[model samples]
Target chain A: MKRTPLYEEHIRNNGRMIEFFGWELPVYYSSIKEEAMAIRQKVGLFDVSHMGEIFVTGEDAEEFINYIITNSTFQKEDHSIVYSLMCDKKGFAVDDLLVYKFNKKHFLLVVNASNADKDHKWLLENRKDFNIDIQNRSKEYALIAVQGPRSIELINGFFPIDVAALKYYWFAESTFNDNDCLISRTGYTGEQGFELLIHRDHAVRAWNALLDKGKNHGILPCGLGARDLLRIEVGFPLYGHELNEKINPIEANLGWVIKLDKECDFIGKENLKEFKEKLSRKRIGFIMDRSKIAREDSVIMDQEEHRIGSVTSGTFSFCLKRSIGMGIIEKKYIDIGKLKINIGEKIFTAEITHLPFVKIKN
Target chain B: MVEVQDSLLYAPSHEWIRIEGDIGIIGITDFAQSQLGDIVYIELPETDENIFMNSAFGSIESVKTVSELIAPVNGNIIETNEELAASPELINKDPYNNGWLIKIKIEDKKQIEGLLSPGDYEDMISGGNE
Candidate 1:
């Protein structure tokens, strides 16, 4: 199993290490629910070094990225990040990623750790005649996220640049403890936060520094378990669960990121246009009546027990104090208000609700 | 740092039974509850329901995963813990005492002899050869 640079730090902090996608990472340091609540109320830090970072640099980098992703990168300013999905020629999702536009000649793609190899292969397969160089920088950098309502308080003045001045979705190249790094106001949690990308050699020092400085602000080290629950609460589509090679962005309720009529044609524009016009399945959130948590692949049925779709993700939302989940259901059956979820031999009643089980002010 | 009571008998699957006359008070061990993390929901069999040894009686759902509650011995469910429906974290807080799942009327006294001793159960969990 692959180990991150901060593996020893995690061990020292008493993190319960577990195998995740062939990587040994911490599931939680203290408790999963408590760590999640800390992110919601105070502040939390996470070792996101397992995420992949691939750099695309050359004269035609912008044009190459535009043709690869569904979202239009035409007018996106430099140092800004755009959340988009990469789809295959058949309009199904290859992977969902964040595109960091450093400039017209240089761009960075931060992708899921599980999809790193597959995404790199896809990028190479589509690099037919573009004058761009694709470099997989997954091992060169480590990612640390400081997230929550009090995240700004903990991050401000830590670097030479005014971190508070950094706008949302924008990044600034700065030095941390004399090490070159990039600080971006981006995170998976809905709360305010920043994702700092530093060299792998300096990650352990930076993590310890942040913990020491954040002692007064009540910052807790979180794990992948809490991170998963937090994203589910915010209705973010996980790559393998809510999306895959067969599920398109339109079916996953991510159509807002796809721009079909852009000046530069993308790989899946034509098929995506057809899918947009004839939508079939739609992703929706539902809340269970009781504490019966609906898990992934739990069958969804109508009042008469007719099959509609199945659950993509589910968990007990610590903030809402109830069970919530997202599922891809037939568009025709989404308005039935209440649906039945089959878990084991028992059937649970779920009330259809909008995406995001909880509301975030920021 | 899991606690094991010397007076109780343990199942291989981590359920513990405190024998009191013909009534066996059954609940999960400390190691089992800790492994499951924060318990959010628990499904227990109804009162008077017949349950067999080594069969799944219900389930326990945590934040990230779900685990089936395996029965340790054949018996009739005389009473099920009702408080866990609203507050399932009780198992995480006190798995041996307030977190007891069910009270069963033992069908055969010979079945109790087959259960593991507290020391053996502790050894199995602590990576000792059992």
Candidate 2:
């Protein structure tokens, strides 16, 4: 299994280690509920170094990126980030990623760790006649996320520039202790947070320094287990669970990112447009009446036992103290009737609610 | 270090049984609760249900995953934990006392002898050579 640069730090902190996507990472240091609550209530630090980073540079970098992703990058300013999805010809997602634009000739793509190689291969296969260089820099970078209500105050003075001035989905190039770094106001926790992208060599020092500075702010080192619960509570889509090669962005409720009428046509524009016209399934969030969690692959049925869809992601939300889940069901049955989730031999009563089980000011 | 009661009998599956006359009070051990982290929900068997030895009588759901609560011996369920319905974290806080799962009428007294002693259970969890 691959270990991150902060593996030793995790061990010293007594983080309960687990295997995640072939990476030896921490599931939690104390407990999942404590870490998750810390992130929601106070502040928490996460070593998300397992995330994949790729650099795209060349004269046609903007054109190539615009050609590949569903979101348009034509009018996007430099140093801004665009959350987009790359799709195949059949409108299925290649991967959902954050595109950081440096200029018309340079861009950075932060992708899922498990799909890093596959995304690199897909990009290479579709380069065709575009003049661009795609470099998979997954191994050279370490990503740290500091999130919560107190995250801004914790990270404001740590950087050379003012991180509080950075708007959402925007990044600023700065130096961390004289080392090059990129501070982006982006995170998956649905809180006011920042993702600091630095080299792997400086990851250990950076993590330790943050913990030292965050000592008074009640900062705790969280793990992937809390991260998963946080994202699910906010209705975010995980790569393998909420999305896959066969699931398109439209079906995943990411239609806002699909710019069908952009100046330059993307890879799956035609197919995606047809899919939008003939939409069949839609993603929705549900909360169980009981405390029982409805996990992935659990079948969703109507009160009469007619199968409608399957759960994509589910967990016990510490914020709400209830079991919440997201699923894709037939569009016609969305608000028509009640839904039940089948777990093993038991059927749980679930009520369809709006996306994002938890609401945050940010 | 996990705490184990010397007066109780343990199953290899990490459940403990306190035998009193013909009744057995069953609950998961400290080691099992620690391994499970914070339990959110526990599926308890209904009263009057017959659970066979070495079979799953119920299940426990923690934040991470679900684990079956295997029966230590054949028994008939007489009562279930009522407090766990509102608060499952009790299992993690006190696995042996207030976190007890079920009370059963023991079917066979010989099965208690087949269970592990406190020393053997501790050794099994501590990675000691049996």
Candidate 3:
């Protein structure tokens, strides 16, 4: 399996390694519960170098990207980032990504690790009349996400600039450790954090430097296990589980990113407009009666044992001290009520609840 | 920490059976609890249920995954651990003594020889075959 630069560091820290998206990534260090709680209370760092980074440059970069993605890319200024999804002709989501407008001619798209190659091929095949060059620079860059409430304090301790002034979804290119790097105010966890993109060779040095500098802030080396739980707790959608080629952006509750009235014809606009008017499946949250957590692909059933939908993601939420899950059910079964989830031979009773079961008050 | 007395017979599945007269008190080993990492739910088998050797009696759910509890001996379960139905973490906190899963009436004394010794079970787990 492919290994990141911090693979040795993860082994040294006694991290349990698991294969994720063809890459050997750390699942946890001491315990998943401890690592998850650390991120919620203090600062935590993650080695997210496996996420794909594709560079789009040339005269027609913005126009090409705007035509492909389901977000208003033309309105975004340089050094801004917008969460978007690439859809097929049927308005079904291929992948959800972050489009970074680096400059007028250059744009970077960060995609899910497993869908990197597929997304790249799709972009190339659809680049029929657009004048743009797409380059897969995933192997050239390493990403680190330092997240939590005290993340700014840890970052400002080493960097010279005021990171607090950088608003959300904004990025700036700066020099760190004598190398040029891009720092962005974006993170998956629902907290104040930054994502740093640096050269691949300097990955270990930057990771160790941050660990050394942020030792006092209780910054621990988190892994994909904590990352999944944190994102789920905030009601964020994972690509393969919550989104896929069969589900559309509207069904995933990401309609805000789909701009249909922009006066320009784009891919999947017509189908999405029709879907927005008549959505059949809706995404909702469910809370299990006990700690018997439902998992992805588990069948969601009504009181009469009729299969209405399926669970997309489920886990024993540490913050809520119960089991919670997200599911896509038919609109007929979308009422705010109770339901049953079949987990193996047992059927767990669940109540239809709002997304984000645990809300952190600011 | 629960005590693992020398009088108890250990199973490779990390279950320990303490024979008291004709009754056998069963619980998971301390090593099993550590490996499971925080038990969240325990599904206990019903009382008076006949369990076959090496077959699944019930299941234990943790934060990461669920593990089936294999019956170490062929016997009839007389009593189940009712308290664990509400507080499953007792299995982690005291896997040997207080977290006992059930009380079974031993059906055969010949099955005792088939079980592993403490040293043998320790060597099997520490060999890192899992």
Candidate 4:
């Protein structure tokens, strides 16, 4: 298994190691629920260096990205990140990525760890017509996510830039510990945080520095287990569970990012438009009656014992003190009504609630 | 680790039963609680429900997974620790005392002879084979 630069750091923090997306990473330190609650209430640091970072540069980089991604790339200024998805000819999602438009001739795509190899190969094969040079720089840089309500206060102590000036989904290049880094105001958790991209050799120094500086601010080292719960609480879609090769962006409730009216003929544009006209299934959130946890792949059934859909992600939320789940059901069953989910051998009664089970106070 | 009193009887599944007269107090062992991280919820059998020996009586939900608690002797549940329903983390804090699950009226006292000693139970768990 591949190990990131923070593997030793995680071990030192008494992290329970597990294999995820071909990387040996920490699952939890003390408790998943406790760490998750800490991130929502205080501050938490995560070693997210396993995610892929692919750089696209050349004169036609802007036009090249607009042809492949679903979002309108021409409107974004330098050092701005836009969440978009790349789909196939049939409009099936291949991968969901965060595109950082560093300059007019350069862009950086941060993708899921498991889909890195496949996405890199696909981009290489599709670059024959465009005047762009693609390079996968995933191994050269380490990514750290400092998330929570106090993340801004904790990170501001190390950087010299004015963090308040950096808006959401924006990035800026700055020097940290005498090394060039990109600080982005983006994170999977529903909080005000920054994702720092530093060189691989400087990963340990940077991680330790953050822990020492943010110690009094209640910053703890978080793991994948907490990350999963935080993302689920915000109703964010994970690639393997929510978006896959068989699901389209329109059906996945990501239609806001697809700009069909723009004057550009992007890949899968025609199919996505047709799918939007006849959308069949949609992702919805629900709350269980009690603390009985519903996990992924649990079958969703109606009151009459008829199967309707399946759960994509479910957890006993610490913030809400209840169980919540996200599921994709047929359009016919999208009513704000009652549903049943089969967890293990027992069926649980659930009520359809809106997305984002946990609301963040601004 | 909480010391297992010599008067208490133990089950292979890590449950402890302390008998006084015809009534028995039952709870999981400290080893079991430590193995199952943080407890979030506990599903206990209702009062007056008959429980069979060596059978699945109830289940405990932890942060990572769920574990089934087995009955040590045949009996009828007389009472359950209701406080655990709200704050199940008590199992982690004091599994032997405050985390006791239920009180039962024993139907068979002969089953107590089959229970392992505290040393034997420790040997079984520390063997690292489970």
Error of 3 at B81 (Å): 3.5
Steric collisions counted per model: 0, 0, 0, 0
lDDT of each: 0.92, 0.92, 0.86, 0.87
Give the per-residue lDDT of model 2 (tens digit) for A1-362: 99999999999999999998899999999899999999898899999899899899999999999999999889999999999999999898989999999998999999998888989999999898899999999899999999998999998888889999999999999988789999999999998899999999999999998899988889999999999999999999998878876566788898999999899989989999998998899999999998898989999999899999999999999879999999999898999546988998799999999988999997
- Expressed as tens digits, the lDDT of each residue in B4-71 for candidate 2 is 99999999999999999999999999999989988999999899998899999899998789999999
Per-residue lDDT over A91-125 for candidate 3, one digit per residue giving the tens place of the 0 to 100 score: 98878899999886899999999999999999998
Worst 10 residues of 1 chain A by lDDT: A244-253
Chain B, TM-score, each prediction? 0.97, 0.97, 0.92, 0.92
Candidate 2, residue A256: the lDDT equals: 95
i-RMSD values for every candidate model = 0.9, 0.7, 1.4, 1.6
Tens digits of per-residue lDDT for model 1, A221-314: 9999999999999999999999976567899989999998787989988899998999999999999998788989999999998889999999
lDDT of 2 at B51: 88
Sequence-dependent TM-score of model 1: 0.97
Q: Which segments of candidate 4 are over 4 A away from where they belong? A: B1-14, B19-22, B127-129
Q: Considering the two chains of model 4, state its CAPRI-style docking category.
A: acceptable
Q: Kindly report which residue stretches of model 3 are placed more than 4 angstroms away from their true locations once superposed.
A: B1-8, B128-130
True contacts kept of each: 0.84, 0.68, 0.42, 0.21
Tens-digit lDDT track of model 4 for B6-86: 667788898998889899999998878876767777889999999999999999887568889899999999999999978
